[model samples]
Target: MTTSHKQAPAFRPDWAFLMRHPAHLLAFGFGSGLARKAPGTWGTLVAYPLFFLLLALGAGPLLISLLCVPLFVLGVWACQKTGDALGVHDYGGIVWDEVVAMLLVLAWAPAGWAGWLLAFALFRLFDIVKPWPIGWFDRRVHGGFGVMLDDIIAAGFALAVQALLASWLPV
Candidate 1:
């Protein structure tokens, strides 16, 4: 006997789709999420400067880490609104999850451009590969929580990788 699974409809949100609401605008990462290819990568790239801005303001790791709670909350709401508008949960073009995930990874990442770069690569790797728990959440969860949970798991993985490398790798 063969089991068949139905796939969710694919959607490629355009610029106008993001313009419909403020949440959509943010969830789309100010249009970076609208990229025809690798929208998540683009969204992650957009996160770097924002992270730097907070660091530049003298926000310590603790502050940055604490910010994750509110950011995740906002991200959930934004993702929910945008997902509802798009009629898809965790749409590829909805990239606020990537943006927030970068923040979580960087919150624990070592200081310096090299550290940030490594964190970025690892986060993207796990986000794309979705191993173990991340894949489980991505498959089992739905709605806004589902959208953000997998990326948050990926960030946790990236954080561990970054910590492991920081002790051994020279920057």
Candidate 2:
């Protein structure tokens, strides 16, 4: 069998395609998927939350969460593009959902690193386990809102578990 040499697939930043729509830029966190596709992982990571969080920090955490919704909408759109580019469904790096869910969990639990760690573990567990409706949504849903919904559901499960565990254990 003759083997043909193939070049390594290079990462392409889809600036032109992205620039056609401005909403995605506004949605930095959620659009990290698109950013991930364009800048790859590192570029997306640095830029994803930096400018928005900075511009948003002045408004306070509550306002920041509120602002994230629009960003989320746009991010979902961006995720669609990224998914197409990479030819995968729900790439791990495109984690705007995780960010949003994590913050929302914090909003509910209201504690220090302990709570954050619990939340992180629980969210990841539920998300990976994909229990019940979270799994259903993750499989059935498509596009941006769909992408965000399953993680939100997973976060809900995570939040509930953390709350119960926190109350019971009292750590």
Candidate 3:
């Protein structure tokens, strides 16, 4: 008797694929999602430089917060297109959600490295753990909107914890 082996399909996206469409680039967090490990963390880190860039351009925290609205909307469209093309509704490499959500977190996070670091840690924790309603949405929701919603909820959870910590401790 002879046996045949079937190979799993590869889904590795290269720079060419990322550059093929604007939506892919955006949905992939400008290539941050291409990381071999922890693409979501890498994508979340992209928000730091972007936040500083917006600040350098004279946008305050409030303005940065406002910017997240449009960015989130754009992410929805970009992620939808990219997901459709990749045949995965919410692939691990689609990290625009993390970028947008982290941007929102930074907008409300306390000043200085310590605070920012805490915010980053908290955001990542909530995102990865996906507790309560966050898990609810992540499990039940589908498509681009669902892909983005869970991270937004995680950001909210992070911000809430940050607020409580700020009230009790000095960051």
Candidate 4:
């Protein structure tokens, strides 16, 4: 519902826009990059794994981090295409960016409740602020990697901030 940018293109939300619905959320990821045709499809498809992020991660951080690049790529593309599909830049429903960003932020974070909590807060903050390099990347770049790197950068900033906070606070 919150608009992120003023320059958002003017595409109408389509069936894939239904992916934003809460009912068929699971199915959204199945069609993230698919054409925007069905209701609640892509959003549902992408949202499940996003929901999974706070719950589980059986793999090691390095592996998961590596896995994230492609997913980040996917997120970038998803955001751009979703924007194009809906005629908006950084649409609210295109949370695939948030998904990739959150993962990237925690990719190497300490696996503690405190660390996770701090990371979540810092990540969301940095994402919203788009500070420093995050802002730089968000503004100057274009395309999939462009969409992704700003978040990736913000996540890195959050990681650094969280690490410092963790060290200083020490739960």
Q: What is the lDDT of residue 91 in candidate 2?
A: 52
Model 2 bad stretches (over 4 Å): 1-65, 168-171
Off by over 4 Å in 4: 1-5, 8-57, 168-171
Q: Give lDDT: candidate 1, residue 38.
A: 98
In model 2, residue pairs whose N, Cα or C atoms come closer than 3 Å (at least 3 residues apart or on different chains), thus clashing, are: 30-75
RMSD of each: 4.0, 7.7, 5.5, 7.2
Model 1 residue pairs with clashes: none
CA shift at 102, candidate 1, in angstroms?
Answer: 0.6
Query: Compared with the true structure, what per-residue lDDT tens digits does model 4 show for residues 39-129?
Result: 2233323433553563475666677778777877666656565555555455444555655667666666666667666767787778777
Per-residue accuracy of model 2 over 1-171 as CA lDDT, tens digit each:
111112221344344544544533322343454543442232223432443454455654466457557756766776565544544445554566666665555555534556656756676688678899998998788666676788778868987898887754435
Q: Which model, 1 or 3, shows the larger lDDT? A: 3
lDDT, residue 87, model 4: 51
> In candidate 3, which residue ranges exceed 4 Å CA deviation?
1-10, 167-171
- Please report, as a residue range, the 10-residue window in candidate 4 with the lowest summed lDDT: 22-31
For 5-43, candidate 1 gives per-residue lDDT tens digits of 223324567777778788999999899988978999999
Please rank every candidate by lDDT, starting with the best: 3, 1, 4, 2
After the best TM-score superposition of candidate 4, give how far the Cα of residue 21 lies from its true spot, in angstroms.
15
Give lDDT tens digits, candidate 3, residues 8-57. Answer: 11466879989999999999999999998999999999999998898789
TM-score of each: 0.91, 0.61, 0.91, 0.68
